[model samples]
Target: LVSEEELARVEARLRSINQFAPVMHCTHSSVSVDQVLNIHGFDLQRALKASPELLNTSAAPTKHDARVSSVSLDQSAPRHLRTVQKGELDLDLLQEWIGELLNNSGEDIFRMKGVLAVAHAGKRFVYHAVHMTFNGCFDEPWDDEARESKLVFIGK
Candidate 1:
């Protein structure tokens, strides 16, 4: 476990580079595994429940400046795009399009995530990508909720 003073210093450094950096959560052996997992897991449902703003697909795209190093790092800010569509999508075509996007601009794309309504499927498709690596899987059944696709991209 990091000392409180050290943690504060690290957070300060991170905020200096990117003001929007999320708060750091530290865990130790004393913490239960389930609790730690809940805190650090990449579960989108948990995230959406915590921050409903992520579902606000109608909001305008925004950009934020990020600077790592004064000498070598690119000073350009990252841009965000949120897309919302109300139709079922072809899984094969969507995969192909995502592949093409990664092929064309993977380096500039920091992260991409979406919940998709796939044609002929009862469950929602959850997709996530970081740089050139991506994965998708069928999630919980849509049940009675409206089938809508929402995608968010954060990149240069």
Candidate 2:
């Protein structure tokens, strides 16, 4: 769902990636094909050395007036990893947040997703959205996996 130019535009907006958790960098699309399939020996060390900024990131600041943009929320939720402190997020509050996001957008929000750990419950919620359409449901109970919330929204 992202192109090279779009990725570049995003990369241009980063400051110190203080957390080292930017979604795109964490979710890089496999480029091994450009190596293995093309018979070019894949060299991880060479690639890392060549892209110095990937190791020390600081780039032109983002201009939100531009077409494409992003949002990151470090909202605390019960049992979630975005923060260590315990917090509560009831279903009503969850819906309120989602409603505001969809309603506030000028159809500029193309997508979103959330993995939530609810207050007073052993289960979690998984939600997805595209424009005004969204779907959500209670998922399996908490497991050994660390609960985390992740959302990605892209728009023009």
Residue pairs with backbone atoms closer than 3 Å in model 1 (clashes): none
lDDT of 1 at 96: 93
Task: Please count the clashing residue pairs in each candidate, in the order shown.
Answer: 0, 0
Clashes by residue pair, model 2: none
lDDT of candidates 1 onward, in order: 0.74, 0.67
Q: At residue 54, what lDDT does model 2 achieve?
A: 53
Question: What digit string (tens of lDDT, one per residue) describes model 1 on residues 1-156?
Answer: 789899899999887754544564856635556654545536667666766677798876566467311121111223232223357889999999999999998888888887888999999999889889999999999999988777767777
Q: Residue by residue across 1-156, what tens digits does model 2's lDDT show?
A: 679898776776663333222333435555544433555444656656755555554765545767777765555444454543435477798789889878888398877777777777677888888888889988898788556555566676
TM-score of 1: 0.53
Worst 10 residues of 2 by lDDT: 15-24
Off-target runs (Cα >4 Å) in candidate 1 are 1-36, 40-63, 66-85
